[model samples]
Target: MRTLVVYESMFGNTAAVAAAIARALGSTDAVRLELADDRPAIGDAELVIVGSPTHGFALPSRLSRRAARAQGADASATARAGVREWLGGLAAVRADSAPFAATFDVRQAPGAVGAPSHRVRRRLDGLGFRTIGEPASFRVGPTAGPLLDGELDRAAAWAEGLRGLAR
Candidate 1:
């Protein structure tokens, strides 16, 4: 199946997780990995995965992005709107042929509240996309981090599990 993985990263941790997930699902030829800033078309996607870093108990706001950038986040990281803005197109989804979607978010730690995955899942579901599973979260070490050791491996495993739902 053709899969699309869209991610918004403030400190690059979310980008790494998105790349790992796309790689796990298949080769680049079969999986399209895009940054939320790119505002990629959801065209022909059989499986769509969206991920972003959690902020203020939900998706990052413009103010949050600005704050992150001020705190040593790369300028490129906040160059444009992130996941919250990109997901606005959810309204364009056609119920008759919407794809299956799953959401993920990078958090400060495990069991942390305010993960954006919940809101993302709600949006996708309201827009008529069939959700194959609950949203997933990956932990990051400090605020700006190297993903807490084996998080990438765990992300890949989580992505591999999503493939089963496509069948």
Candidate 2:
């Protein structure tokens, strides 16, 4: 089945996690990977996966937005928009064609803080999509971080497990 992987990344950690998930699903050529900037066309995709980096305990926290603006008014290219905004604007899916949905996020370990993935899942659920597993999280090393070692492989495994559950 066709799948769409959408993500928002500040330091590329979330983007890497999204890529790993797309790869686990199948050939990169077959899966559509999108950054949150553009409104993604879900088309006939049977599965939809979304991701973002956790900022200030939420999806694109206020502080992150302020920081991005501080980077530059032209920081749109690097910071762009975030997944929360993208997901918030999604048109409601019809009941018949609503795809199986899932979400993931990248963040620091000891994950007590809230995550973007949970909010993504809730948004998908409210849009009438059926979710097939718990949201996933991949760890980053620091605030603007390279992901923790082996996290990509772990992400792949997590995606594989979710695929199994969906079947």
Candidate 3:
């Protein structure tokens, strides 16, 4: 099935996760990887997967920050707006009948902290995605992640599982 893995990355950890997901989909021809700004066409694809690295509790980094700051938005507002804009771009093509999923990648912290996955999942659900599964996270290092053992394999496996949800 056709699939698109769209993602936002800060220190490249998230990009690695996106790549792993795309690889597990096993569709060299049908899968595509895109920076969130490229606004990939998901119309023909049977699945659309959106991912981002967590920043400031529930925000996405880099482009989302710039997009928000340019408009003088706060962290929370920026995140909400960014996700909305990203999904809005797909609205013209994404079939209301088709299914979609969302996930996030976060750095491994030493103690308990907030996770942005639930917020992302809620946003995707609001956009009418089927909410196929719980959001997933890949551990990252303080700088340039040593990726906490097994995260990449876990991401690939998660992607493989997600494939079953495709319609």
The best candidate by TM-score is 1
Over 4 Å off in model 2, which ranges?
61-63, 68-77
lDDT of 3 by residue, 1-167 (tens): 77778776555677788888888886543787877766666656667777776656655655556653564434332332334357556553244565566566555664325566667677667767666766787787654466887999999888888776654
TM-score of each: 0.94, 0.88, 0.75
Candidate 3 wrong stretches, greater than 4 Å: 27-29, 61-85, 88-96, 110-113
Q: After TM-score superposition, what is the CA distance of residue 148 in candidate 3 from its true location, in Å? A: 1.0
Q: What overall lDDT goes with each candidate model?
A: 0.86, 0.79, 0.65
Which of the two, 2 or 3, has more TM-score?
2
TM-score between candidate 3 and the true structure: 0.75
In candidate 3, position 17 carries an lDDT of 88
Per-residue lDDT over 1-167 for candidate 1, one digit per residue giving the tens place of the 0 to 100 score: 78999989989999999999988988533899998888888999989999999887889889988889888899966646878998985565788888889999999967847779988988888888888876899998888997888999999989888887865
**lDDT, candidate 2, residue 108?**
91
RMSD of 1: 1.5
Model 1 steric clash pairs: 57-114
What's model 2's lDDT at 80? 57
Question: Can you tell me which runs of candidate 1 are displaced by over 4 Å?
Answer: none
Q: Report lDDT (Cα) of residue 66, candidate 3.
A: 69
